[model samples]
Target: MNINKIKNSKNNFKLIVITAYDALFAKLFEKESHMILVGDSLNMSFAGKPDTLSATLDQMIYHTNAVCTGAPSAFVICDMPFGSYINKDEALRNCIEVYSKTQAAAVKIEGGEDRADIIKHLTSNSIAVMGHIGLMPQYVRSEGGYLVRGKTAEDIEQLVKDAKAIEAAGAFSIVLEGVKTQAAREVTQAVNIPVIGIGAGNVTDGQVLVWSDMLGFFEDFKPKFVKRYLMGGEAVRKAVKQYAQEVQNGIFPSKEEEY
Candidate 1:
């Protein structure tokens, strides 16, 4: 699907975005979700890392390729991992490789005003970009952990400015994460491009959540913004336990089943 469908549906439809790191999940949710992000959260969710700082470009490409292969018709966006895009040249090179190798529709880069130029460069080169602002996980260590942003006047002002800058830089959409509700609302109103919220607020044009978090598959920790739809992890554990019990009781290969 064309990424513009999301950009153009600003007030028409509430876009749905979900994170996926592999082919099976991508295929399963392809029809229900408007977009699938190969988010760097995989560093924590899939790789058992403490933070997103360790996610690599190669890992992102491998996962993005899998998602793209499974959901060919779904719009997929891959995150440009930490240290992969610190400058115009580096950003362009990595983004090009990601787009060329994975066939994802776009790449999401973390940062705000500082990334405007890089966003422009990528867009100009025919590579779509999705901007990420507020509580960037890649900067968690430097920022002193995952604090909610835009709590002060100065913070709100900069957020609005960043949103405008990202829109002007030709990003098709931006992810507003862990920002104050009022500030998130203002940013959504300030940008023509779609704003997808995570912990930001319901005022955004769309919403995104980590797949495992929402499905209760990743039980390591639960963020405040996530809403669990199913106790997937618990269910899996129960199923495994039941299988072991049945095996111990010699319940398998009954008389009617000799092959």
Candidate 2:
């Protein structure tokens, strides 16, 4: 189904929008998801960058192309790199350049109230928009770290306003990430558009998790938001540890695998 149709399809169905970076994971997410976003969490999880803002436009386009090539039907979306879209005119131009790289169905940009104008400009021109709000990693420095948003009453009010503005600007969906469960639930209820949760909560219309977290890639820190589906890192570690032991014993190839 198309993006517009997806929202109308089921208000209660709860679509799954996953974060997949490469072709292999894209295929997996596409199989189980209604849509896939080539999120810039790659900077932290893949490139080993300290944060998301370090990701460059070229890197985002390159990985997004790979994902689009791998999953043709899942309405793939690429993330706009930091500083890629700011002013209305610059927003339009940068958005076009990214859309030209591959058949990515949309581009996700951070910010909410501040970016409403840009979102309107892009979506009005037929570029699908997925808005990111609450605990934006791209602003880690300004945020002083990845903390849960909307804790204070006034902050919650502001978040609600931001979410409503995003939907009014024609965003098909908004990501409510790393917020309190109550705030995430409130945001979901407040916005007409779909709310996709990361660390937000299960009450949202859809849920997205960085592929590495789902597949057990990160070793240093695990946020309370992500739930590991497969301990891939641990599995790999065990396999390699055993392999090392095998090599030392000269039993890896064994008798059967040998020609």
Candidate 3:
């Protein structure tokens, strides 16, 4: 079965994508989600890095391999880490490495118009592709920070151009990040392919979140778009506080494992 067809078919089935860093989560989610993205968001969510730029190709490949193993049948896609796709040859090489090493159905890169050449090169070689637009974290330096894009008419049109270019360049789908509500809808409607939204509102083909963010694992930082599903950080703190109190009172363990 063609994975790309799943995104375009009249089934009207909403694609569900989740970032899977390890085999366990991949195995668990594969059966449920339409796709599993071995996202480099692992930089912030897992490795405590400031953002996605910190994730290396090696680390990304390792997780991609793990996630693919768990997702025997799901469409697996790996994110090509920052700088891996700067030079044309390097981009192709990285795609080949992850495609061969992880057995992922596709690979996602953060760009729209500029990376159009890279997109064409990879897809031509039979590697499926996914496009990421909007708040590209990899461009944090050029963007001056991780703020939203396409607020003005000119910016919005430029965004639309980028999205279209990526789509026309053979990206099976585009990732619409941190854009206004109406603009997100326009892009989705305008593009024939899928648009996976993060902070881009709900009218797109799908929605995704970093697992840690949704679970509230990072207490010190929370993005505006993330809806906390579980307060893991809070729970951990409470448990640690309780353990400290028990240890101080000399009541820890309490003979639970005593012979």
1-259 in candidate 2: lDDT tens per residue? Answer: 4776667634658877788888888887787888888889898898998888878889988999899878888788889988888798888888898888788888898998999999999989978899999998888898789888979888778788889988999888888888888888888889777888888878888888887887788877888877888898999999999999999999888998898
Better of 1 and 2 by TM-score: 1
| Residue runs of model 1 more than 4 Å from their true location after superposition | 253-258
Each candidate's TM vs. the true structure? 0.97, 0.94, 0.90
Model 2 RMSD vs true structure:
1.7
lDDT of 2 at 198: 86
Clashes of 1: 0
Residue 42 of candidate 3: its Cα lDDT? 91
* Cα-based lDDT at residue 82, candidate 3: 91
Which residue pairs clash within candidate 3?
none
Kindly report which residue pairs in candidate 2 clash with one another: none
Instruction: Score candidate 2 by TM-score against the native.
Output: 0.94
- Superposing all C-alpha atoms, what RMSD in Å does each candidate have to the true structure? 1.2, 1.7, 2.5
Clashes of each: 0, 0, 0
